[model samples]
Target: MTQSMNHEETFENPIIPGFYPDPSICRVGEDYYLVTSTFHYFPGVPIFHSKDLVNWRQIGHVLDRPSQLNLDGTPSSRGIYAPTIRYHQGVFYMITTFVESKKGARRNFYVTAENPAGPWSDPNWLEDAPGIDPSLFFDDDGRVYMTANRVPPSGREYPKHMEIWLQELDIEKKQLIGPKYSLWDGALKQIHAQEAPHLYKIEGQYYLMIAEGGTGFTHSVTIARSESITGPYENCKMNPILTHRHLGRDYPITSVGHADIVQTQNGEWWIVCLATRPYGGEYRNLGRESFLVPFRWENGWPVVNPGKGIVEMTTKRPHLKSFPWPTRPACDHFDTPQLDMAWNFIRTPRDHFWSLTERPGHLRLRLKPERMTEICNPSFVGRRQQHMTFAARTMMVFDPQNEWETAGLVLLQDHDFQYRMESALHESKNIIRLIKREHGEEEVIATQEIAGQRLYLKVEAAGQDYHFYYARHAEEWQVLAEYMDGRLLSTDVAGGFVGAYIGLFASSQGHDSLNVADFDWFEYIGVPQQ
Candidate 1:
């Protein structure tokens, strides 16, 4: 992976702002490696590294290597699901599930690498595991076990019939060895649904940590433990170890769950998981991305979100030792072969569609099929949404003479609900404007003519709303759309496990030739108090 040289100030809250989700973290000898679900974003499973959890840097992607993953025709919301990162004997492993487009085709897969930042091995299919969110546990006795969701034999419907299951695995053969046993059921006695199982053993106790509550604003974190690997596990006396309960219907951090736990150098326990915050109770452009939470053990059970049982916007860093003293670069000038760890695709991405040039320091994105549904095309690329409130800005230059070119920055979430500001040919003249995907139409919300081919566009999402802006001349910036209701762009309203993501985009909806977009720099600023 190519590293950036541009020096930029890194903010604290959104450590990695964009659209990353389903974070699984592991600490190896003073260094931390964080991986998250790609969900159709080819070059799947973004891997981020940090010396200090607060200062994260995109080292590389585990799925970049073909042997690691593949998604030729994967849907916008189907490819990679929740992934769990585990390290055993210096080899790093990630277990996950792939939901095929056809019915009854969901399957579990695994990948391994000697190094966290590496050329990972190809995925190995584990059959008979018919569910999502597969996790691995390598015990001290040199035994490997798998825990995942399985459809109940009685009912065929999902979300209502899924149950957590456990089975021992033969790592050498890449197959299950023993009979599967039922561990727990999500719909047994709760309104919240179950998924994302991460198994581990702490101090002789086998722990099973899972996420429930539908991964929505009502999402929550839950845990269960057993004396043995397959016996009846007991739910935490106080379930929902962590959550943001104070925010009514529209606070920032909504749909937070799907977690993986790790132990720091000081034996401190911490979790890296997914969560989202609407900008003014309206938009979740960054989709459910990654988050960090502290874990404490009380009276033999795990306790998180312990303080008044509410997640906080600003909390103290996890109690872990910090090394790698100085942090890596944050601001990107787009001068590398590989995009930053902060970058991802909504669906599988075609390598030929995007590039980062070193000579002029710009991101060149080739236009893909216009009006392509988010599910199938490999054109989308994005990053994890890591903040409740922030400002994302990018500068781009388009082919002014080309009416076929439409390039802009987007605050994207699934297929519906997204705000876009692009450069297009308007009345034979190049105009920069803000357009939104509302009620399934690309309605023009704001527009302004430009003198040259260069323009800077930005989206600011804070509290529970969003604002769009643009600058033809670098020094003077103009607001296009202000504090628009974001819920119009939400999954609850738009439908998807994702939130909004702000990034560069290009498309040739119905053009004769390919449109090109060149991005100069992308910056994100955490929202400040009024």
Candidate 2:
């Protein structure tokens, strides 16, 4: 076993930081693959690959095609839930549930691909599979089982009452067969919302691990084991193998659960899960991020973080050799043929609405009739605000002939809660405006008229407070809005399962327009925390 390393060599927690939640990982040989939930964002389920478990790079997304993912009219935080990725017989199977479709329908589906990256098959809808967080387990005898959380057939005694269910799966036929059986309710009695179940067979025992106590401050990971795959599983005496809930709200890391484990080629065990790094008193603008923790077997159960028993902000590196991956570019010049993996749209993007090749070295966004606040797809593309203190700047040249057309930078959380700073023609004058929307009410906090066509817009965040600035020249920046409360863009205030996104947006306000906005470049710089 590898001993703890010096501080200089230690890897940081939240190995894959920023809005990457509900992490599910699978190891094949020396390679480790991971997947995270992307609610309502098209090209969903970002897949990442790592060699040493500490350094990871996003290889691709599972649902890259519009046909594979349909999020039209789906609410901001209501489309795709937790997704579980598993490798079986040279094929990668990703199972997930789509809740609140355009027509308000919920469904479960799975997709398969020979490789972890690219060209994944279209959704094989599991018409009979009920519930979210579906996981596929291939037994030693080549039998496949699907495990997920669903309402008990006997009816719920209380709200959010759920149990783990297992059913036989036919891989070739792409369907679930045989009788469904309840494996374990949960580790705690009367605990609602027991979900994100993953089954493993180790040393002749079938172990079932699950996330309980919801996904909030009380989130936890509990384990149960049984003699048979389908049997009366018994809860572990040292239940809740990992959690940060009991550490109090003052803890740096909160909401730690929904973990997936993998044993390395050198026989080292590690767990990757979702946890939040809150700033300025229990408010997390970065949302739940992927965190890593080392664990060891005690008697038979895994002891997470060993003597610590709680997730730490920094931990010793995995025993395997370090394989450092290149970091994403700090600025995007729109020179690439396609948007980087870091960029995502609100929903399914209209093919002709945006492009990078239309004008060399620029991202052109055509004016769309739908407003940014609408449920439909808007001409918007953004990256997650991954840091508590950062500055996001974009240079745009928009010549709006009418008041209906607007384009600029936005710090968006959802429809009702967002901050938009844009340049538009108001009263036949080219004016820059700063608007804030809270719970469906809109307010124009700042506005300025300028003569230049090229404008530089920036939003600087410092500990839950954001400052909006614009410049006619590249170096001259004037504050347009100051000390704007960023908490309004948080999940706690916005009431969603997503984090803040900073991106370029264009809207026509229900009027057809041929006008387009050209973004010369976009840059994001993380400010060091004090």
**Best model number under lDDT:** 2
Candidate 2: where are CA atoms >4 Å away? 1-8, 101-104, 528-530
lDDT of 2 by residue, 1-530 (tens): 55444536677778887899999999988899999999999879999999989899998999999899988878888888899999987999999989885346668899999989878999999868888888989999999999999888888777788999999998889889999999987555656789999999999999999999888898999899899999899888887898887899988899999999999887878898999888878787888899999899988899998889988877888878788998778999999999989999998876689989989999999999999888889999999988898988989999998988999998888988899998999899999999999998999999999987899999999888899999999979999989999998888888778888898999999999899999999999986443
Stretches off by above 4 angstroms in model 1 are 1-18, 51-53, 102-104, 156-159, 186-188, 243-256, 305-310, 316-319, 324-331, 357-359, 372-389, 400-402, 461-465, 478-483, 528-530
Candidate 1 residue-wise lDDT, 104-194, digit = tens: 3788988889977877888889978878888888888999999888666666454454678889999999999989988978634664467
Q: After superposition, how far is residue 121 of candidate 2 from its true place, in Å?
A: 0.5
Q: What 10-residue stretch in candidate 2 is worst by lDDT?
A: 1-10
Q: Against the true structure, whose TM-score is highest?
A: 2
| Clash pairs for candidate 2 | none
- TM-score for each of the candidates: 0.85, 0.97
